[model samples]
Every structure is written in C-alpha cells, then in structure tokens.
Target chain A: MIKKMKIWQLPLMVICLVGFQLYSDVVLAHGERAQQAGIRMRTMYWWDVDVQPTTVKVGDIVTITGKFMPSSFWPEHLASSEVASFMNIGVPGPAFLRMHSYVNGTPMVRSTRFFRGKEYHFKVILKARQTGVPCASCCQC
Target chain B: MGYTDSVKDSDNQSHEDTSRSDVSQDSAISTPEQQRRIFRAFDWMLVPVASILLGGIVVFLVALTVGDWDYWQDWRDRRWWPLVTPVSLMVAPAVFTYFFWKYFRLPIAATSIMMGYMIAAWVSRYANFHLFADFPMAFVSPSNFIGMAIILDSVILLTRSFYLQGFIGAFLFGVVIYPLNWPAAAAFHTPLVWDGYIVTAADLMGFMYIRTAMPEYVRIIEESTLRTFGEAVTPLTAFFAGFLTILNYYLWVWIGSKLAVSRWATKLI
Candidate 1:
C-alpha cells in the first residue's frame, strides 16, 4: 500500500510543477508601476503621445512624438525641474538607439530647465537595433 | 588448569607485541612519502580555492569603490575613469603581493589573483548584464587586466624589493590602464554629429539605453575645463592616476604586512 501511494505522489508533484510554470507571469521589461502612486499622479502629465508605424524591422526608423506638461502642484519634497532636467525615453536596455531627440523644436543633447505648468512638445527619432516589443515612455530626469 | 591458562596468555601477549612492532615499522618507513603526498594534495586543493576567495573579495572592493566607472563603457571617460579604476584595482594586487612574497616567496600572487578575477568578472558580466538584463555583450564587457597584472608580478620578481615594485610596477600599472584599454574604447570616442550636437558613439549609446533609475545628471564624465587641452587630457589623467596608485599601493602593502603577522591563540574557551 505504501509503495502504491509513493508512486502516485510523483505524478501529483509533476502536475503541480507544470501548472505553476504555465500560469506564472514572466517579467520582460522595467517595472514603472513600482513607483509611488503619489509621485506618478503629481509629476509631469503626458498627452498626444504617438509611436508611428507600430511595427518596425531591424534598421528601420521609428518616430515618437509627444507633449507633456509639468504639474503646477508639484511635490514640495521632490527636486524642482527648474534646477536641472533632461528629456529622455525609458526603454529596456538598448533595444532601440535614439537617433535624435528634440524639445519645442530645440535639440535636446543636454539638460534644460523646465518651468512649472509649462507645456512642452517633444519628438524622438529611434533606430531599431534589436527585435523586441519595446515599451517606450517619456521620462524627465 | 591454572598452568595451562598462563601459558596461553603469554603466547597471546607475544603475538600482540610482534603485530604492534610491524605496524610501527611500516609507518616509520612510509611517513615522509605519505606526508609529501598529503602536502601535494593540499596544495592542489587550497591554491584554487584561496585564489577564488581572494578574487571575490577584490571584486567586491572594486564594485564598492569604483562602482559605475568600470561597469559601463560610457563611464570610461578621460578624467575620472582613468584615475579611479587603476587606483581602486591596485588594492588587491598590492595587498596580496606583500603577503605572498613575504611568506611564500612567490611573485605570482598578482597574476594568479587577476586570472581568478577575470574569470569571475567575465562570468558575472555575461550572466547578469547580457543574459539577464538583455544588454549587448560589447556594451557590458569588463576591461582586460591580465597584461597589467603580469607586469606587476614581473616587477616583483625582477626587483625583490617592495619599494622598487611600488615606484615602478604600481606606476606602470596606473599609467598603462588608459593606453591598454584605448584600442577597445577608441571607436566609441570617435566624434559624431547627432542632431547638430557633437557627441561620441558612447555618449549616444548612453543616451539611448535607458537605465531605469539612473539619471543622466548623475553621470560623472569629463565635463570640466580640462577639455580645452583636448588630446592631452588622457595622458595627464594617466600620470596623475599613476601617482595616486603608488600611494595606494604602499598603503595597502603596509596594511597587508600587519595582517600577515603570525600570531595564534594559546587557548579557546
């Protein structure tokens, strides 16, 4: 009877392991959601964000255009954008190479000061270097 | 009956004494060869393990001190990278050089430790940066140090004095770092115009690859007025690094000497 029970246990364990593996969520990109809710809500607000030609082949160029407004009610604890800020893209590793970036038609190769409550239009040209579903988001540093 | 028992006991005692003597004779003859074999086995086991442990400690020290300077190619600037990396890296080799040379009379400590560090570092760069983070191998590859390590060991071997080793070997170790790594880094340093702004390929790559939490402003590259010198920046940084490396080498060697003192506890409670 003991021998029969042990034989059944092996199959049960294998089924459990396979089920877990199948249902588990895989992480392929950065966790922006891990940021504090207050920070996410109070910081810069993005709109008119668009990525053209959704599909891109290796060496193909993709253009991302967007507009963002710095919130008037910025968190007091956070550093003010007036001191120093840089417009950038948040992507996983080097999935795409940024060919060019512009803010209000001005080239953004270095940090620039941003006034609170000011709306800024931006454009970014990216060259695809690797094949992946890149999650690109505008970031202020 | 008593007489018979005594006679049997005497025979047993004689047999036991003869067996004991034979065993003693065998051990006495084989002791030196057995000891030699045991020591050989210990050397085979201990050397690699010790090297790996030392290598791990050195990597940890480097990670803490040098931090991002050695991690990313873009961080390998003419100023801080050239200055910081060699000085930080010299710690392990300098410390172990004193320990190994004084005790074992072996000048190969730096070479062996560096070999171990390179193996471990390459494995880590591949496993953590390339495979896990999906970064390109070229982007996250570690700098080569075997050539520098060999020179350090050779210095100690040639000049059996630590003072001379520090003056010559340590200075060379620091000065050569930039030149040694230049071939790999020169392509990245080539000037390119991106959107009417002059930037290096490394700068472009740094801007493109988004390190989630690391901000652009935090990067400490060559941003000073020293850029006016242009081509002279790297050599100036290397010479300064060499001077600092000599100081660091002597400091670590002194610490190593103190640690190498042969003191033992008489009893454990």
Candidate 2:
C-alpha cells in the first residue's frame, strides 16, 4: 500500500543513501579524444620514452623517464601569454599513486615561467595501488 | 458523494432509502473536526516521498554543476566564473522549485530539496569508487550546499512566500556561498613562488595532476590586469550572481505553482 510514509522514515532513508555511497569506491575517467586536431601534436614533440617493470601487484613503484621539446604554437583563447606553468604527470586514475616527479633536475612542486620553445627532461615515480592494465590520458587542450 | 447521489436518485422506490440517505449525507457533509483529522494525516505523508524525489534531483544537479562543469575550481581562477556560475546554478534550483511547490508545499518541499542535494552530492562522489570507475574521486569531490539550503528553507519557513524566498533567499545564497567555500578553498589558493613566478597551490595542483576528462580548462586567476583597479571584483560578481538567482527564483516559483495541478493534499499516496 502506498499509504502515508512516516516522517521518521526520511531520516532513516537518507542514512541508507549515504551508507550505500560509503561502502564501495572506484574511479572512471576520460581519454584519447581529449585534444583538438594537430594541436598538442604540433606543440609538443615527445621522444626517448622509457618505463621499467610494466607489470606489478598492489603498491609497487615504477619509474618513467621522458623528454619533450615544445613548438611555437599555443592556443589563442586559452593562452594568457608567458604565464607560470608546471610539468604534470598524466595518469589514468587512482589505479596508481604518484609518489614524486622531477623536471630538468628540479622537483616540479612549483610553477615556473616555461618559455614557448624549450626542451624539458622529466622523470616520474608512481606506485601501483590496484592490479590492472596500465592506461594513460593524453592532454592537449 | 457517490453514495448520497445513488441513494437520493436511484433508490427512490427502495424501502431502505431513508436510512441510506441519512448515512451517506452524514459522511459527505463531514464535521469540521473530522475534516481536520483527515488533513492532518495527509500532512504526515509529506516526509518519505518528498525526500526520495528531491534527493534524486539534487544528485543530478550537483553532478552538473560541481563535478562536470568544475564550477568551484573555475571560480577560484576565472574572472567571469563567479558571476556566471550562479546564473548557471540558478537553473536547477529554479526548476526544482516547481516540484517543491506542486506536491510538498513550504517546509517539506524546501527541506527535502536542500537535504537531498547535500546527500546526493556526497553519494555522487562515493559512486566514482564503485560504479564510475577510473575517475579519481579527488577530481570530483563532494560539494557543500548546506549554507544556501539552510538559508533558503529558513526564509520560506518564516515568510511562507516564494516572493520573499526568491528575493531574500537568492540574495543571501549568492552573497554567502563564496565565503562559506573559502575555508576549504583556501588550501588551494596557498601561494607558492616557483622560479620567479607567483602561483597558487591550486593552479600548481591543476597543472601537476592529470584528469583526462579535464585537459585544458579555462583559468584566468589573479594574473589578469583587472586587479589593477583599487578594489577586487569579487564582491561585484557576487552581487551579480544574486541578481541572476532572483530572476531564476521567480521563474521556478511560477513553474512550481503551475505544476501543482493537484490540489488534493493526499494525491501522491
């Protein structure tokens, strides 16, 4: 019977809703088609990529080293001109934890005035939290 | 009504017509005291169903505003975000007001929507872990609308009018939200000097972290030349937000009242 629902039941219902959310946890993200045509490709030329120990169990650390040289082209609407920028490690999700990263022999903890045309050497260390295939996202926007 | 009409018209030749008429009329013309009791039962029914529907709506709206659009993060950085975000946000609350007015009335409607929105936000953040896998929970954190929701409900409770609720509630919500969020948002704004550049903790984190969904979001923080003026533009933006909220409130109130087609209090049951 769809009779009157009790006032007290509402509070209890909210409690249940929250309880459902608290128990299980995971994350899904976007990838691949993130950038515009020939934008990031034209701007950043990445080469000499190296990754060791591709397969690992929970909580295993892996090292990655790469270098990229920037081109002169920057997006018009997004670019604020010679502003502070940082070298970011692009990963899939909480499947792996980012421990630390270094760019050009400096800990990339802060933003720097990254010139338009410059070469950057980068190294990153990540710990695997969940056992799964290694997936990464490309950001050009 | 059915009993009275049947006894009076069709039972004219029946022997028991008089007794049937008396009983039917008595119930049809119910005493004021009995009517009061029936209405009171109807009121009790407000709680459960209101919560479920409102809560569902809240989750959808929260995902659109805080998670998908990343409005909060945008506010910290963009010059136009503070002004436009409220205008954008007003859309959900305004559309929601129609449901609030139609079925639930004042207190129950306002309270349900408010509480539901908060709960939904938290739940959406949680769902990423279990259902929407591969997206970091950090990218879509739980939003806090407790302040605005409370203020909105308080206005309707006190004034019992959508007019004042819109005029007062929207204004207060617009003015206070930025400050209420500041306690948590402050951590993001923490200043750091890196290689002769003054950047916030938030900007750096955004640059460092990788969320494939959000590659290059537009961010024009304090570095803009607009700060050259003596006073900051934040307050003006808040006021603009308030104005837009009011407009949205009026529209939603009109909508809620219109959808409130059923006058019978116990219709939902």
Task: Pick the TM-score winner.
Answer: 1
TM-score of chain B of each: 0.82, 0.67
What are the per-residue Cα lDDT tens digits for candidate 2 across B32-84? 44545655666568666666666777566645653444432423533454555
In DockQ, how does model 1 score against the reference complex?
0.19
State fnat for each of the candidate structures: 0.40, 0.27
The segments of candidate 1 whose C-alpha lies over 4 angstroms from its true place after superposition are A1-48, A51-62, A69-84, A112-118, A127-141, B1-41, B213-230, B264-269
Question: What is the Cα-based TM-score of model 1?
Answer: 0.71
| Per-residue lDDT of B41 in model 1 | 82
Q: Quote the B-chain TM-score, candidate 2.
A: 0.67
Q: Candidate 1 docking category? A: incorrect
Where does candidate 2 stray beyond 4 Å?
A1-41, A56-60, A72-86, A110-117, A133-141, B1-46, B68-89, B95-108, B129-141, B181-210, B213-237, B254-269
Model 2 alpha-carbon miss at residue A110, Å? 5.1
TM-score of each: 0.71, 0.62
